[model samples]
Target: MATLVSILLLLAMWWLTMTTGALAISPGRVVATLTGGGTRIENLVIIDRRLSRLLAGSLIGFCLGTSGALTQTITRNPIATPDILGVSAGAGTFAVLALVRPETTERLLGVSTTVALVPVAILGGLITTGVILTLGWRGGFDGYRLVLVGLGINALALALTSWLLTRAEVEEASVAVRWLVGSLGGVRMGDVVYLAPMVVLAVLVCLRLAGGLGALRLGRDIGQALGVSAGRTEAGALITAVALVSVATAAAGPIAFVAFVAPQVAMRLFGTAGPPPLASGLVGALLLVGADFLAARLPLELPVGIVTSVLGAPVLLYLMTRHLRRTSV
Candidate 1:
């Protein structure tokens, strides 16, 4: 009931800002525009453009949030996020490469290969996740080593992405930049369609592994003592996390901070003692919806990623401080 109320409250807030064009429009007029009671242009602006983008942003946030929680919990590390594991970079790389491909460009917006951008993004994400997990698992997965190796891989993937961006055409580079900053602008239902299946799969995989995640919190050796196959559990978690982030990033670029923020928020709110997957997903949806709503109202018009960063950075700092204090104690 509380969750429902919170969701409604957030939605109301979104409607209020959008209607009032807190960023630009009068509240009543925005509603009229969406309801088809306003001018054709208003309908085009509000319903066709803004609403679709908002939905996309919310969906992307949800995907990243849950995936991040799953990864953090499975690894027993507060710092674990999809970005750290190179999934976002992998997705970004594949998308950029597709945009630069002549066949893809000629056939579609930038490219027209038999292989679509979504699949390429998913495959890349999976490969990166698999490699990171394999490297982290030495006899048994260690969270400390996992975080270190994941960060290294993420850095390498980012370097490759920068190089690819340089080699890409100016138009492709422009597209890539928008993706990097992670905006929901200009998104359509077709793009959402491409992301839906992967998100569903990831969610299902997470749900299936929830029990294992619970055990993982007690450490791998203990989990193994309790009949949980640490290797399989870790592998499943990595795959799910990668798939979710890959689909989300592919759909809306890498919207920075949602993965990190949502899971942390979930852990705090639920007092899970670790990550809370379901709570993380709900928080993620709310965070994105709220952030996008506020972004929509901004005069200078910041991207959703900017909003998330502004909100997430402080939380990250707080977490670091807490971690340090705990370690010293």
Candidate 2:
């Protein structure tokens, strides 16, 4: 029932995106446009422009939310998101680097700019995850150690990103900055085509692994005794998360706390011991779609990331306060 409500809310929000934007198309017009009965202007506005933004926001949020659930569940930490774990930072770094220095990236990586920066971004995220997992697995990928190591690595990745930006041309830097902050603006159908299948498949993978993950929460030994391979499940979840973050970053930049906040909010709403992937994904899609709507309507115009950060910061602080109290007790 909660899941159904969440999905309905996502659809409601997405519907509002079409009907309530700057152009102020009516809901009826939007429906008509979809069914092929609207004006030329309505078709261009709804199909060419707004629909891409809607799909981009929805897809990015869903993937990030699912990734966050997997990461938090695997690490057993509510606050452990791809954003904090250096995956987003790493993916963003490489993607931004490619944007600002496409020639160099192509030269060094033997990748073509014609194909987009997805490969470089995925490579960067995988490399970063490989290092963090290797280090975090020194004895075990415990939540505390993973978060701490992730913080250090995340800082380094951001520093490198900053350096790359400073050396970029003004035009390139302007483009890079917008992408870095996460904008669903200028999304095209081609990008959506690339993103849709992967996001759907990845979320399905996360859902398929849910039973084992739920059991693994009891403890490794218990999970292992129950015929779950702790190592295999953890690896699969983390890898899925990395792929989701990498591809989404390549498509839409690192969109801030959708990954972190979505899962936590879903856990609260559903009363789960750990965040559940599909429900968390629905909430995430709602959050991002809603954030994009707000960003679009705001007086100054803003990247969607700013809205997410503003909304998610308070939650972060509240979680920190709770974490502190629990640890101190």
Candidate 3:
């Protein structure tokens, strides 16, 4: 009931802000813009321009949140997330690589923007995620080992990203910066259409693996004892997690903490001793809606990524400190 109420509240807030012009587009006006005009200018701009970006952000948030929970559960690491695992970084790397190669980037745009990002992003995500899995394989990818290796990968990826940024032209760098920050501006319907199927598929995969993931928390030997194939479960969960994060990064850049914030909040709300995938999805949707709403209202026009980082970092720090204290005691 609380989850349902929270979803409804966020929807209401989104609608209210959009309708009141607080979102930079009045509600009635935007709707009319949606339903209005054949061959009209404002109508084209609203439908083609605004609505696509809105949906893209929302959908990506849902996928990322669900994936985050699955990743954390599968790896048995509370801090494990798409961003932390270098999935987004790997995806972003491929994306920037494509953009830097004009001939290839042009060829990519031929199909669709979202499609262009998906293939490379998914490949990159899987590869990077696979590396971490391999690194943590013998020890069964426990929380501490997973996090430490992942942070190392993340650091290396960041350095590579900086190197890539330096190699690119000035105009490309400007574009890359915007992509890195994550935003809903200039998104196209093609992007929405292309990304939607991948997101849905990834979410369903996450749902299917939820039981296995729950069992995984009991530790590998116990999970295997219970008839769970630890190897297969981890692989599937990792694939799903990578796909979700890849699609989101490809579609809307890396929205840093949606994965982290959503699962944590969901677990708290559900009173679950561990991560809840479904609950995390709902929380993710709510967080994105609220962040996007505020992004629309605020003077600096922050991206959803910025909002999550600003708000989530402090909360994450607190959790870490509290956990450390408890463990030490």
Model 2 CA deviation exceeding 4 Å by range: 106-114
What is the per-residue lDDT of model 3 for residues 174-286, given as tens digits with 9 covering 90 to 100? 87778888776646787778668876786677678777778888888888899888889987877777888888788788788889889988888888878887778778877
lDDT of 2 by residue, 160-238 (tens): 9999999999988988888888888867787888789878788678778988899888877788899987888988898
On TM-score, the candidate that comes out on top is 2
For each candidate in the order shown, give its overall lDDT on alpha carbons.
0.76, 0.86, 0.76
Give the per-residue lDDT digits (tens) of candidate 1, residues 131-244: 787887766667678878888888888898889889888987887777688778757777767666766776777788888888889988888899998889987787777878
The parts of candidate 1 lying over 4 Å away from their true place are: 22-39, 102-115
Worst 10 residues of 3 by lDDT: 16-25
Evaluation by lDDT, superior candidate among 1 and 2? 2
Q: What is the C-alpha RMSD of each candidate to the true structure, in Å?
A: 3.0, 1.6, 2.6
Clashing pairs in 2: none
Among all windows of 10 consecutive residues in model 1, the one with the lowest summed lDDT is 106-115
TM-score of 3: 0.90
- TM-score of every prediction relative to native: 0.87, 0.95, 0.90
CA lDDT for candidate 3: 0.76
Tell me the TM-score of model 2. Answer: 0.95
